[model samples]
Target: MEQASSNHTLQAEIDALKASLQQTNSQLEEAQYRLEEANDMIEAIRSGEVDALVVKGEDGHQLYTLKSSNLAYRIFVEQMTTGAATLNRQGTILYCNSRFASILELPLEKVAGSVFCDLAVASEISNCNELMNAAWVHSGLKRELNLITSSGKEVPVLLSLQAMQLEEGLFMSVIVTDLTDQKKQQQLLKEKNIALQEAQETARELNANLEQTVRERTKELYSNQERLSRILETMAEGVEIIDTNGHLTYANLMAQKILGITQSETDDHVYIDPKWQAFHVNGSPLPENEHPMAIAMTSGKSVYDFEIGMQAPDRERFYISINAAPIRDEQGTIIGSIGTFTDVTHRRKSIQQKDDFISVASHELRTPIATLKASLQLLGRMKENPDPVMLHRLIDQSNKSLNKVSVLVNDLLDTKKMSEGQLQLNKTCFSVAVLVNDCCQHIRATGNYEITYEGDKDIMVEADMDKIDQVLVNLVNNAVKYAAASKQIKVRVVREGKFAKINVVDGGPGIPQDRLSNLFERYYRVDTKDNHYSGLGLGLYISAEIIQKHGGKIGVESKLGEGSTFWFTIPLA
Candidate 1:
C-alpha cells in the first residue's frame, strides 16, 4: 500500500511538469509569431510603404509623421517606359500611371477604381485572376496575355505582378510591357529563318545532284549552241566574230554575203584598208579606230546602230548598220568583239530620195502656184483696162500653170493607186506604131530636137489605149528632158514572136551601168552633180508599172558615155 501511494504522487507531479512545459512552448511560439510580424513591418517601413510610426519614448506613445517621399515615387512610376498600376487583391485597379492609362487607351481617373480584369481579353479573364491571386501569395509573378482596349483593339502584353504590403492595404503592382512591335519583329524573324532553312535544304539537294545536273546541262548547252548557229546562219542580219588579233574567226552565211567575204579572206584589217574607205553617216571619214568593232574592243563597251557608208572593192558605195559588243573572258578581260551588221544601203538611199523628193516637190508645186497667182493678180488688175493681147497671154499662162499642177497631182494619185493595187485597166486593140507617132507629136512641136518614128505602124496590140499613150508620152519626154546635148530622138516599133517591142533611144550623157538596175524603182532618180532636174522621179516607175499591167516587160540599157535605150515589149493583139 505504501508503494502505490508513492507511485500515484509521482505521476501527479509528472503531469504538472508536462502542463508547464506545454504552456512555455506555446508562449515561445507566440513570441516568434510577433517577431515575424515586427520584421514584416520593419521591411515595409524600409521600403517606404509606412507613412507614420508610433514610438514609446519618455513622453509615452509619442506619434511622429514621416516626411512624404510620394513625389519621388510618383516621378519614378510616371517616368517608367513600361506601364505601371496598383491593384487590390480582387484585381480592382486602385492607381495607374500615365503609361498604364495609355496602354488601355483610357484616362487615369477612368481606369482608377475600375476592375483590372475588365481590361483583359474575355478568354484571359480567368488567367488574370489566377495571376493576381498568385501574386498576392508569391511576391513576384509574370504572365503573357492579351488585353482589350475601349476601341476593341487587342494588345499583347507582358504582365509582371509584384505584391506589396502598404500602410493602407495589401496591393499588387503590375508592370505592363507592350509586346506589339516585339511580336511583329519576332514574326518577321521567324519567316526569315524559315526562308533560310528552305534555302539551305535546296542547296543540299542541288549539291547532291550536281554531277548529273551538270552533265544534262552540258548536253542541253550543246544543243542550244547548234540551234543558235543555225539561226545565225539563216538570219538576215550579218553576224561575225573576230579574235583578239583582229582576225575574222567566224562569219555566218549572211555576214559573208553582206561583206562580200570569201573563206580565204579572214583578215579583219582588210576592211579597214584605204581602198575600202569607210565613212560615217554624216559623210565624215571613219578612221580604223572609229569602226564599231574597233571602238567596242578598245573601250570594252558596246556600240549600237552605228551607221557607216563603206565603198566596196568594186567601187560600189553601200551603207551598213553595225552593232558591236566586246566579248570578255572569265576574268572580265576583253578577249575580242562580236559584231552584227545589216545592209542598210537601200534604206539609206530611200531616205535620201524621200528628202530630195520633198525639196523638189516643194519647189515644183510652189513655182506653178506662184505663177498662177501672179497671172490671176495681173488679170484682176487688167479687168477694167480691157487689154485683149495681155489678157490672152495671162490666160494662157494661167492655163499652163494649172496644167502643171494637174499633172503633178495625177502622178501622185496614180502612184498611190498602183501601190494599193487599185489601178484599173481598160484594154483595147491599138496600133503600136500609130501610138508612138501620136505621142511624139508634142515633143516634135517643141522643135528642141528631131523626133523620128520608125516602126511597124500597123502592128496592133490589145491594151489600154490611154495608158499606152501615157507610157509613150513619158518615154518621149524623158528623152527630150535628159538628152540635152543630143539633137535627135528616135522611136522604133517592131514585131517579134507574139509581141511588139517599142524603143525610145536618146543620145546624151547616159546613166551609169550601176544605176540601170534601180532605174524603174519608185522615187529613184539619176543624181546629177551639176544640175538638179525638175521632176518627181516617178516617170520611169509609172511607165514600168503601166507596161507590167499590160502584160509586158520594160528595161533600160546604158553605158557611161554612150547613150541609153529604154525599151518595152507588149503582146500582140
Candidate 2:
C-alpha cells in the first residue's frame, strides 16, 4: 500500500510541476508580444508618415529635428533617402537626380554628398550665390555660367534656380544643365530670323511695284476707251453695239435717228431688214446664223460693205453700206459684234442726176454757142474795115455771143466753187447802195431788158460787196434769160428794223412747191432731160452761198404762171 501511495504522490507532484511550467511559459509569451508591439510602433514612426520622430545625440542629448513635411506625408513614403540633388522651380534638376552618382565616374560615397554646382556649373562663375539669390528673390531664374570641374576642365552650363527651405538654411535649388547643343541652336535661330526679315522686306518692295504697274495699265485703258468713244460718237457713219444674242446694247445719236426712234424708245434689237416678221437678213431672224454680224461673230472675222436697205414697209427706200466685226474676250471667245452703217441714198440719187445733167447740157448749149463762136472767129480773121454803123451792128451781135459764152463759163465756175466749199468772200463793211447801183448799171447796159429800182444811197450795211453784187447780177440775169418775153424787171431795197432787204421781180415760169425744197441743190434743174436748160443749174446755189457768207438770206416767192420775186436780206453794220 505504501509503495503505491508513493507512486501516485510522485505522479501528482510531476503533474503539478508541469502545470507551473505551463503558466511560466504563458507569461513569457505575453512579454514577448509586448516587445514586438513596441518594435512595430518604432517602425511606424520611422516611416515619415507621422509627424513625430525620434533623434538623439550619441551622448543621449536631443538635437535639432523636424516634423514630417505635409508634402512628404501626402506622398506616403515607405522609404527615405537624402541624395545630393538640386531642383529648379519646374522640378527639373540643376545638379542631378539620385541616378547622377553612377554617371559621375567616382565613388558613390563622395558623389552622393557633393553639391551639384561643384560638378555642373560653368567655369567662369566662381560662386553660385549670385545666380541662386536671384532665383530666390524672383522664384524663377536661369543663367548660363562657366565652371571648372574637380579635374580642372571648363564646361558651359545653364543654371536654373528656385527657392527651398531646408534644415540648414534657406537655399535656392539651382539646376545645372549643359549648354553645348543649345548654343548651336540659338545661333541657327538668329540666322533664320535675319533671312526671314530680308525676304519680308523684298516682298514689300515687290508689292509696291506691282501696285504702280496696275495703276499705269488702268490709266492707259481709260485713255483708250475715251478715244474710242469720241471716234464712235463723232464719225459720220452710224455705229451700234450688239451682244452675242444679237440684242442692241448701245447706239450712237446717228444710229438712233436712222432707225427712226428716240434713244430711250429703241428696242433691245433692230433688224437689218425690219419688214420681215420672223426672218429677214439672217436665217430665222435678223442677226441669225447667216447675217453678216452673226457670221463675223461665229467665225471671228470681219465683213465689209454688206448692203442693207432701209425701206420700211413702203417702197420708198434708201440704201445703207455696212461694215461689221466680231468682238472677243480674253480667252478668244466671241462675245458680240459691232456694226457700222453709212447712208448712201442721197449719194446714189445725186450721181444719177449728175449723169443725166451731163448728157442734157452737152446737147442743149453746144449748137447755139458753137455757131456764135465760129461766126465771131470768122469775122475776126478777115481784117476788113467796114462802115461804122455796120461794124457797130456786128460788134453788138458778137457781144451777145460773148455774153452767152460767159453765162456757160460762169455756171461751170460756180458749180466748182459750191461743191468744193471753197467759194470765198471779202467780208467787210460796205455800202449796199453802191452794190445796188452797179448791178443796176449792168442791167441797163442790156438794152433788151427793162429795169425798175427803188430805195436811195442812204442805206448802209455790212456785206461781202462783190459776192452781193454777184448775187444781184445772177438774179437779174436769170430773170432776163428765162423770161426774155417779159415787159420789165423790178429791183428794190427796203430797210426793216436792224436789217435791209432787196427784191428782184420778173415775169417767168415759177417753181412747183414740191421741187422748191431741193431747188437750190447742186445739179438740180426745173427742166427735165427732154426740155434742157442753158445753165448747169449751179447759179442759184452759188447765189445762196454768197448771201450766206455775207450773213444774209435768199429765197423766191413765185406763182407758177404769174411771176417770181427773188429776195435777199443783209445785216446792217
- Supply the global lDDT for candidate 1: 0.74
Q: For model 2, how does the per-residue alpha-carbon lDDT over 292-357 read when each residue is reduced to its tens digit?
A: 677767876766656554555534556665666666554556667766676766645655676777
* Global fold similarity of model 1 (TM-score): 0.56
lDDT values, one for every candidate: 0.74, 0.60
Q: Which candidate's lDDT is highest?
A: 1
- The reply for model 1, stretches above 4 Å from the true place, is 1-235, 243-245, 268-271, 447-450, 485-488, 506-512, 558-563
lDDT of 1 at 101: 84
Clashes of 1: 0
In model 2, the runs with Cα more than 4 Å from the true position are 1-256, 261-303, 307-317, 324-340, 345-369, 376-398, 410-449, 456-466, 481-486, 528-531, 559-562, 571-573
In model 1, residue pairs whose N, Cα or C atoms come closer than 3 Å (at least 3 residues apart or on different chains), thus clashing, are none
